[model samples]
Target: MYKNIKVIAFDADDTLWVNETYFRDAEHQFAKLLSQYETENKIDQELFKKEIENLKLYGYGIKGFILSMIECALELSNYNINQKIISKILDIGKEMLEKPIELLPEIDDVLEGLQHRYKLIVATKGDLLDQERKLEKSNLLHYFHHIEVMSDKKPTDYLKLIQHLDINPSEFLMIGNSLKSDILPLLEIGASAIHVPFHTTWAHEKISEKEQEAADYRTVSNIKEVMGLF
Candidate 1:
């Protein structure tokens, strides 16, 4: 469908692989740790809610995630937990960092199918090291012509990437999970975008209003269906 498209950019986290699963697991573990000092009710749902709120204020990446962990730990513990408890939470974050990288099913086939026809690029926002580690470990690094790991996913970031590639916005298409980060910004700049919703997504990655109206935007059930759009 998009045979004329010259560049296809993809978001890296939940779009390509399993990211929200790890964060959800970490939050559960975090709640377990908080239960010792606070009531289960107070620390249960509210803890995750606060963390999600923090993500919006601080943005996504390891630094913000770690900060949210710390904040939730302190809030649930009521400022009484010892350093060891805090250390354990931080250790959980580190453990998440070390976990193996994996991709969604049929991702390889889709990439392989598109590689011959379009310039593939990974344009995502997150910690530089963590994102690079993920790409390197996934063994999918070689498929992309360029990899953009930014602190934020804004229209400017998309503009910058397209400018760097010397490609027209009309010739590019972005496929991703987050409407906030991936679709809206690219659509704002006149690039086409495909939304592939993940089963679990960080709260900060939710879609915005303008993104919902872009004519070039399309939604697919999964990564495999994305190839059909093009």
Candidate 2:
């Protein structure tokens, strides 16, 4: 199936490592921290709304998320939030940044099995420095040809990546957890994708069923299945 595939771009967060789990944990902690001001449900909704509203300005990453949380806290508390709580919010982000890199099961095996035959690269959206730090710590850096820290993942962005790799759409394949970011965009650009879903997905990455209609791709329950595909 991959006879024509020259480059396989893997999504970094959630796809290669344990990422969304940390974000979920952070959000839960955040809601608890602000419990005095609002219900946990309300806090979660507002924080999500705030993050979406700030995405254009801040892009995607823990840094932007921290800012959104602070903004949400200030507004939710009518700017009456305790100064100590504000400091705690910053500490939350710092702790997230320092979280250890836990590679998803079989990620190394899949990469090792495929790297020799195809160009492997990380095509993902997030803070460049943080992603680099994660990759360096992952010890899987040596398997990839390069890493592309994208601002967003859309058809145009995938086209740009394919162009950069000097490969035709058919020669490129993307594998990731988010169907919205990884699968749909590749299909739209006439490329291929394989969905390897992580246990958790960020709300922003979810797609409606109507949006999934007629998209051609393969999905595997785990990353190990990838090794068998080739």
Candidate 3:
């Protein structure tokens, strides 16, 4: 099936290593800290709203998430949030940033099996520095031919990458956890995609079942299933 595929792109966050789990944990901590002012449900909703609002300016990654948490805390608390609580929020962000990379099962084996046979690259959206740091820490950097820290994952972005790599959409394959960011965009551009879902997903990345049904992509149980495709 992959006989024609020249470039195999992988997403770096939940697809490659632990990401949203930390974010989810942080959200819980944030809600607990602010629970005195509002219900946990309301705090979660407000934080999500703030995250969506800040997406344009902050994009995606730990730093933006931290800022949104701070803003949500202030707004939820009527700007009367305690300074110590703010410190704790920052600490949560720090811990997230410093968390070790927990690569998915058989990621190394899959990469090892394919690295010599195909052009492997990371096509992920996040803070460039943070992604690079994680890649370095994973000790898997040597397996990939390139790394792309995309501002957004739209058809146009994949088109640009295809052009840059001098490959046709039909010759490229994308694999990731988000249907919205990683799968649908590539499929729309005529590239093949594989959806390997992480257990947890961010609210914004969630897609309707109808959308998933309509998209032409393969779905797999884990990263190791990628090896079977070849």
Clashes of each: 1, 0, 0
lDDT of 2 by residue, 1-230 (tens): 78789999999999999888888889999999999999999999999999999999999999999999999999999999999999999999999999999988888889999999999999989999999999999998899998999999999998988888888999999999999999999998889999998888999999998877767789999989988887
TM per candidate comes to 0.88, 0.98, 0.98
lDDT against true structure, model 2: 0.93
What stretches of model 3 exceed 4 Å from their correct place?
none
Candidate lDDT scores, in order, read 0.82, 0.93, 0.92
Q: Mind giving the per-residue lDDT tens digits that candidate 1 earns over 1-230?
A: 57668999989998889888988888778778877776756665676676568766776676677777787777666777779888998898898899898789899999999899889999988888889999999999889999998768788888888899998888889999988888878778888889899898766566556647644678889899987775
RMSD of each candidate relative to the true structure: 2.6, 0.8, 0.8
Of 1 and 2, which scores higher on lDDT?
2
Task: Please list the residue runs of candidate 2 whose C-alpha ends up more than 4 Å from where it truly belongs after superposition.
Answer: none
Regions more than 4 Å wrong, model 1: 39-59, 208-216
Which pairs clash in the backbone of model 3?
none
